[model samples]
Target: MITDPVNRFIEALHCFPALPRVFNPWFSVDPEHDASSLAPTHRIDNLSRYLTERLGRAKVILIAEAPGYQGCHFSGIPMTSERILLGQLTHKGIYPGDVLSGEVTRCSRTDGPVGRRGAKEPTATVVWQAIKTAGLDPRECVLWNAFAFHPFDTDMLTNRKPSSDELRDGLPMLHQLLELFPDAQRVAIGKVSKGILDKLDIPTSAELRHPANGGITAFRTGFAEYVGRL
Candidate 1:
């Protein structure tokens, strides 16, 4: 069981157990443009705290196919890259001066997101856009991925699909998360992840369109219909 407290897992994770042989682009963040975007420096706890503190009581929970290159896997944010966070801040009415508030815990160092070079999670631009497009808010839904940690197949940094075993292994954590939110509904993106929902006994609607494909269009059109049912 991969049920260790998120922080314990980070401590136990070998320094680059499966680290990349060379620096990968997915791990790099241009801070000038990226803002606070930096790679995850074994900061799973930072993300776990953020999720619990801000969205623990959300009504809907989004389950992405897998962790993204610059966002979840690298930056330790569930879906918070600088671009995404900045947007989230603006959308939530937060400002640059507000970052130091008691709302979010500050992070230190970048995790070798792609080998030792480090990597950042997806920008808030992408994450916030997806959430806005979905028509959700902090009170409306929570965010998550099937795999808590990032996974990759090659040094090229291509995001890999979660395998059957990977999904199965993550089942416990998913269950634990759902149990934390009583009103939460599930939104599984990608066919592979949709199947995991039922297998984990988390009831949800049909599989959502993978964001990379044309699912975004169908999602927009059907968003009203789904919310109405809610």
Candidate 2:
């Protein structure tokens, strides 16, 4: 979905670091997990190695702040929120039953029950479900994040919004991700991405009123007319 010779594009990002799943909860990320959330051992040479090995080509790249404290920050998979994983399943091609049935990793975990507060952050299923609703293909969609590593989690345990300086420092990876999907139309998950879009001169829209906002009816009402054009 990006370009001819995907390796070359991945190679150009040789400076980036890749890592094994680091989400053990005891270990910390800094001075260890680089912006790529990868250990020092991982090289730029393996950029396409993981996803290419796992999912395949992704044309659309979804943007998010970073991983949840319990998810990728602990595990190293970008946007690895268990709630979002459930979302992907509910969408066509993937399902909650099949996921819990051991078809997928069964990573779904939530702080609160469904229809209540504290849903898991960005599980793969919710994302895929959103993509399905958006009328897009997962094989054609490449997923990544602004920081790739989660930075903030005090006693609150809520993921911190990355600072402007962090975003400024961490943005090159965003560019690399952009290069990974030349045809992808970027989507901003939260407010911070406006600056990223401004840096790249790409336009973005505001966050839609999410299901958490009782906006599900509006989503069903008008989303089809909007998604791909952005």
Worst 10 residues of 2 by lDDT: 99-108
Instruction: Give the per-residue lDDT digits (tens) of candidate 1, residues 1-230.
Output: 54644433344332223333222223343242222454333244445555555444577776776566566543455655532333344654433222111343233233423322234343333434555655555446566777655666663345676667766665655665666666677877567677767676767764556545446566545554565566
Q: By TM-score, who's the top model here?
A: 1
lDDT for each residue of candidate 2 in 1-230, tens digit (9 for 90 to 100): 44544455444333344333322221332332223334222222122343453234454455666556544442234544333333442434554332222222322222223222113444443454555667754455555666654556453245566666666665676675566556656655544554555665655443433322454555333334445554
Estimated TM-score for each candidate? 0.63, 0.55
Task: Report how far off residue 21 is in candidate 2 (Å).
Answer: 18
Give stretches of model 1 more than 4 Å off.
1-42, 86-127, 133-135
- The runs of at least 3 residues in candidate 2 whose Cα sits more than 4 Å from the true structure, single-residue gaps closed, are 1-50, 53-57, 82-119, 122-125, 199-223, 227-230
RMSD of 2: 8.0
